[model samples]
Target chain A: MSSVAIDLAAVNKSYRGKVVVNGVTFTVAAGECFGLLGPNGAGKSTIVRMILGMVPPDAGKITVLGKQVPAHARLARAGVGVVPQFDNLENEFTVRENLLVFGRYFSMSAREIEAVIPSLLEFARLGSKADARVAELSGGMKRRLVLARALINDPQLLVMDEPTTGLDPHARHLIWERLRSLLARGKTILLTTHFMEEAERLCDRLCVLEEGRKIAEGEPHTLINEQIGCDVMEIYGGNPHESIELIRPYAQRIEQSGETIFCYAPDLDQVRKQLRGRAGLRLLERPANLEDVFLRLTGREIEI
Target chain B: MMRMTYGAAMPANARNWLAVWRRNYLAWRKVALASLLGNLADPMTNLLGLGFGLGLIVGRVNGTSYIDFLVGGMVATSAMTSASFETIYATFARMHTQRTWEAMLCTQLTLGDILLGEVAWAASKALLAGTGITIVAAGLGYAAWPSMLYALPAIALTGFVFASLAMVIVSLAPSYDYFVFYQTLVLTPMVFLCGAVFPITQLPAAFQLVAALLPLEHSIELIRPAMLGRPVGSVGTHIGALCIYAVVPFLLSVALLLRRLMR
Candidate 1:
């Protein structure tokens, strides 16, 4: 109990009777980087809002940092930092002013805010752009400023919803590196992301959510090994109707796309042998990943 | 030295409320400037065009110059219009297009903080614009020096009342065009009929009853007597009415903002 940072028990939330979240129960261990992986409309934002005390759950208790949410949300929030999905930087102020103004809310003295400003700028590599207007900064720079602003109060728990949602690869990697440093310093983090690779890269343990319910929960490699087979072979086109007919004999599990076929089997060599005899067919084998786990557990296609 | 990561750091959430205010202030500052400038333009035109142009013909009211009648009206007009603009237009944008209030709610800030900060700032802007018009009025010798002191605070409170009222409108408003309906159907007619431009005695009986229900009628009536240095009575009644105007909408706006934000 002492090591638990966030505890959600029997939590349910409904929007105009839609029941967006139903009986979600989980505990985020202190110093653990936990990830919630799901598609859009999977109630990730709903749960995040509930934990932040933005909305009261219909029936349940949410405790953050050992205090009940919203009721004690002010105190709980004092120790928690959040980076939202869309960057909400104030366009009227300079990048530094945005940070300074936010830091003021935590009741930090001017000296203390100033003392941390330099280090924070250096941490996010935004030292030179402090005086730049928020409107003038590039998308990546604004993102970094927001991250730095979130760290101003030096929170014990950090919650970020899709932090790298629309960023390019380089910008995303920069955020990843900064987050890893935060983890090394023992800051507990609750993260939600649609990126499989980000979950695989950053999270210590993750829950896969589909339609507002947790379908699978485990470490990345463990989930891939247990739920998904070691290898997958994607077969494309000999004929539209007869495509599954050809691979069905060898494949233990066969799933069809519009014109392509996916054959999941324990023995890749046997599947390859059958595919070799047939001409005008394409075959590629790769290791299984979170996308495959999502497919196996949620029974949904990997649109990406 | 053993470096502490966050050694009993000042809790960020305490400041969360202020951050929400800062966000709104920064978002609306540009619009506030434009609105203030636009409002100042009206009085400046009065100072240049009406006070001078029509001053030669109409002369003065109660031995005071024509510029005098225009000055008090312009000061009251600026305060009313600026406060109304802040609430109606900018509040709508924050609620709808900017999605600013929604973004702020995701933080530790409560809806009450946002409302207080916004109302305070909007009132401040209206007072400042009122001051500018007053300065011009003083220079023209229409506004008395002592009256400026009392009238400034009065207009500030008046602006706050309207700003809060606009917030309520934004909360209930469904579309941008709804503002036009509000300004045209509700605000424009109210301002004209409220004795801002003419005396309430000149208005018909039905129009006078309608104007009495609106806050601006009381606001202009309260300031007009003071600007004219007339002995006004029942000061308590005016203050009470204005207080109800400001407080009711303010509370409603906070509640509505909280509801929308929580969603």
Candidate 2:
């Protein structure tokens, strides 16, 4: 078995007598990208804060990078880097100044910091804007700088909370590409995002959080396979009752949306064969995705 | 490019404090030199306006020129103003708008480290500003070299005390508007009535007792006597009062901030 970088046992957290994280437990193995998938107010950030020892868990224990949390928290955090959801860069500093200043926290000498900064900037694809003030950067540029700042200490574990939040598609793809590079270089990453596509594309393993509890855990494809069927046929612009009756026999699961009906079947070809005789039905067949797994798990559409 | 604790064995608190100072130094060096230079404009205005303007009216008090009399008080006032604003207003913006402290806490830094770092940095800025004011005061023949040496520690003490008090304000403050209440109601009253612009003896007895309890009053009292060539009355008592003023609020603010952050 691979060594665990983050280990939690029956962790519980509460705010003002209301329990948020209720007896949650999980482990993230070394060199793996573990994604926490949740909707808003799902207590994802709270759990991440506890793991980083920013807040102490009310009950149970957590360990990161082989050190017990909230006790040896400093030691644990020494090897950890974080990219918060908000862009929290110092506006007065240039991009290079921001990186140089953060390097000082880890006691990196000036020459050493100078040497690593170019590579770090290149890693974030922000090499050209190094001398520009952080205030002058775009939202995407700021996000990339935050990521580059997180890398200054050469952390063993990187925790990113909604790292691609509020970014354009191009920026999101760029961040994902950089993250993939980091993973390939054997960096352990813990990420939280509301973007199912992001989780599908990046996570080696993932867990869905609902109201502070782990509702589902597995690989993205495996999750869809177990919770939702392999194939789903979305039938819109047809009579709902007639469509359900017609497609129900061919599907493992049938769901409806206003005027449309969705049928999930193991074999799309067989389902299509059964629907061949039905007229006035516009049918579209596609493979199940993380959205399907998410809806199956929560019975609600995923949003920020 | 990373080193562990700078090759010295240190306690956990010490190590974390160093990290906090490291982060603060990084942050301060990014902005403060310019900030200090900007703040020098305030005392220069005071020297130019208050010293020359008011000097024409009052002429002298306690055998010293009005320009000389006002320079000591202005230095203390600037120190208080800089330290208080640095932590209260600017710190509030960082806490709420920027969320910098929230991110910093996610690292190895503790609440104590943050508190110390901010206070120390503000104190350092106050010292630099105070030094500039002193130089300007000396050039105007308002201060001598002895008072300059005394002013260094005085400015630092004044800044430390106000920075701690402002941190307490930061702990309870939720918005930028709240800082206005602090400045208008609390800081304004103290600056006006706390013997900075004038001696506390000129105030009524009830106001005198109130001023005695204030940190700003104590700061002005501690620094003013030395500048005026007075005996400075029991150095131990002055040190004790200033330390208490700085320490009590510092400990309280740290406790409150730690609870807010860690909980």
What TM-score, computed on C-alpha atoms, does each candidate reach?
0.90, 0.90
Candidate 2 residue-wise lDDT, A1-304, digit = tens: 3389999898988888888898889899999999999998888998898888777788888989888887777778778889998887888778998887677666567888999999999998899998999989998889989998999889989999999989999989999999999999999999999999999999999989989899999898889888885788888775678767766776888766557676888777877776676778788888888877877777766766
Error of 2 at A34 (Å): 1.3
Clashing residue pairs for model 1: A105-B15, A106-B15
| Highest-DockQ candidate | 2
Number of residue pairs clashing in candidate 1, backbone atoms closer than 3 angstroms, sequence gap of 3 or more or interchain = 2
In model 2 chain B, where is the ten-residue run with the lowest total lDDT? B1-10
Superposing all C-alpha atoms, what RMSD in Å does each candidate have to the true structure? Answer: 5.5, 4.4
Quality of candidate 2's docking, in CAPRI categories?
A: acceptable
Q: What DockQ results do all the predictions give, each relative to the true complex?
A: 0.25, 0.36
Off by over 4 Å in 1: A240-252, A302-304, B1-36, B46-63
lDDT accuracy of residue B141 in candidate 1: 70
